[model samples]
Target: MTKGRPGENPAERPRAAVMEDVAELAGVSAMTVSRVLNAPEKVRPETRARVLAAVRELDYRPNSAARVLVTGRSGVLGVVCFDTTLYGPASTLFGIEQAARDSDYLVSIASLPALNRRWITRGIDRLRSQSVDGVIVVAPHESAAEGLRNLPPGLPVVDVGGGADLPVPVAAVDQFAGAARATRHLLSLGHRTVWHLSGPPNWIDASGRVAGWRSVLEAEGREIPEPLVGDWTAHSGYEIGKRLAREPGVTAIFVANDHMAMGVLRALRETGRRVPEDVSVVGFDDVPEAAYFWPPLTTVRQNFGEVGRQAFQLLLDRIAGMEGEARRMVEPELVVRESTGVSP
Candidate 1:
């Protein structure tokens, strides 16, 4: 009887591949494979290419559990945010997760029940217990930003959408610049002065926008109408818009966000005010539906994706013990649509 070579039976399951198998297949030492996987920049380009080819050929995946045991790093990141229900925060979370995935790291989120010192501390503790390599905080409210300033030292941390001059690194859209641009656009169109509809008073974004809008009006020596504060919602915008519609001198208005702008549009229409013809409107945050708004909303386009990417990169740098630029502010663009026009 011919003996089939020891364990070559077709019915036998192929063994799971390991780093040793990959190293052998690539004609390299196990240490070389390790360097290639962990720090590819330190490995010769030709050597890395060969090891990668072997890994693909065997469909090898790194043993993350074993890696943690050996290196004391879980290869995970922590994210702390107040609410993901809102568009800005939700989008920022998505961006961070996407960035983490691209870098072969896992994300563990701790959504806070409230934006305060106690909750922030609890969130960081939860993540620390999981052995996260670093953390990214996505809290835009002043209370949360203030809490971040005194976080217990040791863990690498970065802040997203937080205020300027933070103790940790920060990544955010230049809210001031965006609002200023919107105000300038209205002024350029021959509007005597642009009124403002701002977001909640507690948010850093709202304050930045207010400062920007006021700065422009002051520099241009234009009449600065007192800004109407809203809760960053359509209803608030509608309520405020109704009041503005009744004012005869209100020719141009800059709103903090798109949802409020939609409400303002409705309020104007119901009050017999034709948009642009009677009241030109401009809003921030070019939400997906902004362009579809009746007459299309002229708004500021914030690159949340870029903000997320920068936040992730900052965390990575912090983890590596690098002291790079502490704050990276992304520039926002102005999108012109049919909702705005020359003062009429």
Candidate 2:
């Protein structure tokens, strides 16, 4: 066996690199190292460079627990969302993660099976246990509003696609405006009145869209046709579309989402009705696949990325003990396409 160096234990494991090691290596105080890691703007360029170089050389990772103890922040944000299989929620979550990454913050996500008060609270608790600086809840269902009202005190919370009366700050795409635009677009094409294929009633987004669509029809003194509710799935849209396809009065249809709109298109095609000819269609959520639907869909584009960024910013503000706007809404755009045209 090789002999060990004097007083050196060769069998002992090496000590892990720490912030103090980086500070010593960079010829700076531990405070300077902390500043460089947490608030680099406060450190001089030369000092920051030296600290960064030392950090790389030592492969030093700031101890999150120790940093949280010292600074009261973990640099980790939490996201509580539901069933990411759907496009809207999934895209919103993706946007939040992207924004967090750009800001050099880590994201810890808690995806729940349901949007009820029980599930939402549990999700928040799980994130809180992980020492997240703040949390953004992406539950857009009516059931979640009640849960939001009952959250534990003092933690910064932001809601995405939630109701306006929420106790916490809110950042969401203007679903009402988007739905209204879709309804108005169909009406602009000279359709007598637009019919609506809405999402489930329990969803806040669905209710907002319904209200917007209904508002337009009522304001214009047009016939207010009852909306058919779907489960925000293409299958639901297809089933509902089949019923609408048989009705001659259904000249224009405003769907709550693109997936359902695609279903409607299929139903119309199978029923021998040419889109934008015998019947026009408009949908919300300009999902990527919307443009490829046989007759490309004319839909409302929700700026989910902007909403996510705004939500993250709002959380940051709250975490910093700043009081600002309670709500921020990203405007949705109307994208006209082949699916909608003048009434024949």
Candidate 3:
């Protein structure tokens, strides 16, 4: 194999492998080698296999820039997301990469510092400048979803659970449904009233959770207490949890995220309350550590990978000039564990 070792017997610059080298090794014209790489069907199987064998031996990779010039397609997809290192967005990003690589497309990313209309518009503009065939915006905020209206007409965009009333297509977890299910589970457990510790107000996910929790309470004709807000941080959860733990009717709580739930667990312990005895807690985003938390958190599981994969699928359909925009919604499941139990 001519896969030269980079630092072997160091020289000014080791020779770079090229298609001509592969062509020469295969005993074929350069055009035949090109056909083998781009349109192998046009060449006889035997000849194509021979060219490919030489290509492997020489460690040859075609210049993507040159290939794009010839084929109008960059074979690249752009993903736009927010700056935070939150699990949902990060996992969704990972899912996008996995799906893109599997589909033989390269990925480019643009992370916005905030999730506002102007910032989202700027993020889209930056990706478009890279000549991306399409973009998938990992927008979990209501405002960011609204910004999709300003997208360049027919740019083939997909919003990853952005929110309601978006002009573009969406692929997302049904945040409202997931939250409602969690609330219902607690209500069914005989808790008279279930309290909520929500994420930041601007995020659609946080708002949806609050709405779901409130809807169930209202539906049952139970008292609808105001939701305590957190910034999706364990620290925020701890802060709000301390306050909730002191309240008389805070026997059950549905937190917005798992990280926050951990904090609440600590707060409850500090306040002389025993889990599943005096209080029960449920969290969202079944993070890996949720199971290891004291009392093993009960939570909602958002299929983040599914959200990402479906988003890519919707983007693919749009990029191919399909007739209409399609919004794909994935439902979440309620996971019961030690943290949840029959009301004390």
Instruction: Give TM per candidate.
Output: 0.84, 0.91, 0.90
Candidate order by lDDT, highest to lowest? 1, 2, 3
Give the CA lDDT, 0 to 100, for residue 168 in model 2: 88
Clash pairs, candidate 3, are none
Badly placed stretches (over 4 Å) of model 1 are 1-63
User: C-alpha displacement of 49 in model 3, angstroms?
Assistant: 3.9
In model 3, state the lDDT of residue 273: 89
Best by TM-score: 2
Compare the candidates by lDDT and give the number of the best one: 1
Model 2 alpha-carbon drift over 4 Å, by segment: 1-8, 23-54
Q: Which sequence of candidate numbers ranks them by TM-score, best first?
A: 2, 3, 1
Lowest lDDT block of 10, candidate 3: 3-12
**All models: lDDT?**
0.91, 0.91, 0.88
Candidate 2: Cα lDDT at 265: 97
Lowest-sum lDDT 10-residue window in model 2: 1-10
lDDT digits (tens) for residues 256-287 of candidate 1: 99999999999999999999899999999999
| lDDT for residue 68 in candidate 2, whole number 0-100 | 87
